[model samples]
Target: MQTLQAQIQIPPEFVLISKVEYEELLNNTLDGKFLSLKEVAEHIGCSTAYLKNEILYHPRYKEEIEKWCHFPTSSGDHYRFHAKSLYQFLDRESVKLFLKKKY
Candidate 1:
């Protein structure tokens, strides 16, 4: 086996996430809401691919997903998020309205 060295240069924006930012990412009323990416995708009935593509790419996505899951790296950075944030991302109310309009 060969050893490999690689440096993943994270964007400055992705680096400066503060504690306040993490706390604000959750809905205060949604108690004990932590989830993994697989959990979120399963709950939303979406593929992880869709989460990365549609949801994660939406203008409001970063703020939202960051509130819903974690990507804890070996760099001592805990990027965990809450679960309710996923519901907010789905915007079930808006989808309901849109479907109502369609029908």
Candidate 2:
């Protein structure tokens, strides 16, 4: 049996750190971080209105979206999304699209 290993070359401008340090930094950065609806919509490359109307309210993904988001006001006109959850959801959606195309 043989084992294979791969190495990734870090760019000149990038700093290399141990996994533990990276994890610590990530945790510190993400702790209690929440993004506004407009910020999230911009990050995902969609207009706020489109994000709210098409994906957030769409039947296929609304339930899942709600799990990671909250309406801060009684009117339900404002949304704040947990940073980690939003990233995870986007990653899952990306994988789903990839598999759909591959198959």
- Top lDDT hit: 2
Model 1 ranges off by over 4 Å: 1-30, 64-79, 92-103
Prediction 1 global C-alpha lDDT? 0.60
TM-scores, all candidates, are 0.43, 0.64
Which 10 consecutive positions of candidate 2 have the poorest summed lDDT?
Answer: 94-103
lDDT of 1 by residue, 1-103 (tens): 9999998888877765778877776446566766666776666676776656655555655664555567566886644556565566567544732242310
- RMSD of candidate 2 to true structure, Å: 7.6
Per-model RMSD to reference: 18.3, 7.6
Candidate 1, which ten residues in sequence have the lowest lDDT sum? 94-103
Computed on alpha carbons, the lDDT of every model, listed in order, comes to 0.60, 0.77
**Candidate achieving the largest TM-score:** 2
| Predicted candidate 2 versus true structure: per-residue lDDT over 5-91, tens digit per residue | 999999999998899999999877866899998898778776776777666786888888888899656765778899988888888
Model 1 residue 61 lDDT score? 51
